[model samples]
Target: MSCEETQEQVSLLIDAELEEPHQVALFRHLEGCCECRLFFDSMLRFSKAAKRDLEEIRLVADDILPLHGPLPVSVRAAGDGANSLPMHPSGLTGRRSHRRASEDAVGALPDRRSGWGWKRWTGLLAGGWRMPAPVAIGLALVLLVAGALVGTRISTIAGGGGPMGRDGRVVKPTVVVVCSLPEVQVLGSASRL
Candidate 1:
């Protein structure tokens, strides 16, 4: 492989995404090419630095675990189990570590579907997805009722109450009216009437 191709492959190699043959070819190129080797080292350092920035350590378990021994009544009750670590310290005044520890717990459980309890539903809802079935049904029913009421109001405004038939279209009268004096009207009206 050329030095340019090998340099391009460096990131894929670091991420473990290169196939075996390509990996061997790229390694061979890297062995001979000084510029490509330096580029690969720079990329590795950049990736490590980026990872460190993105994954800053919140409170370590050790920091809060030792503090667990001095349990106030609220904190003790909140712990639920002796083995359970207080992800948040319960006291109002004591430790500002509460926020950091809780943040750590949140960071630890990143998957939306898995580790959360009731909070998973809250996250799903907060993500702007639809509500549950029953709630959606209830909303639909409300919308349907609202639509029907508005339809009635509009029909009343548009001079409704014509004889609406089974299919809901208006039944028009078949008879035709002729315009004239009563005696003159009889001339045309008699046959039609």
Candidate 2:
């Protein structure tokens, strides 16, 4: 690979994100090219320095951010009127802003009811993703009773009983057949024939 391509891949190499074959190619190029090797070493140092700085920042932030209360709102000057966007009250960047938004979200919900327990909860969550304890319990009971009834009916049916059986066992019915044949002609008179 060319020095330019190898230099471009420096960051990916430092981060261990380059695939194996490409990494081998880049390694070979870095070994051959003095300028690309220098570039790669410089980038490695820079990446390490950047990561160290970020860790320090995070350590300082962890110590500082929680000690301070919510930040004061910042107002922007309308230099170019079209570009005048108001600065948010959440400290400086995305992480702080997200934290601030989540903190405010609980108190920001609209309360519609006069009752205390339910209303307070609804006010905090906008009544999202909630099931009352009593309702949940009632539903559980309904399911339990339905399941029990179904189980009992299945047991009765599986015990060999038909619909007409009095006990839980099957009752077979009795069947009788009748047969008849044509009789020979009797004597014309009352005498024996």
Candidate 2 Cα misplacement greater than 4 A, ranges: 67-193
The alpha-carbon deviation from the true structure for residue 71 of candidate 2, after best TM-score superposition, in angstroms, is 8.8
Model 2 agreement with the true structure over 1-193: per-residue lDDT tens digits: 7777888787787877888888888888888899998988888788889988976676556435532235333322221122222334553332444454444335432332334676355334422435555554554465556556556645765785544545544543221212111111222212111
Worst 10 residues of 2 by lDDT: 175-184
Each prediction's TM-score versus the true structure: 0.33, 0.34
lDDT string, candidate 1, 139-159, tens digits? 446555655655654575467
Residue 94, candidate 2: Cα error in Å is: 23
Error of 2 at 162 (Å): 82
lDDT of each: 0.56, 0.53
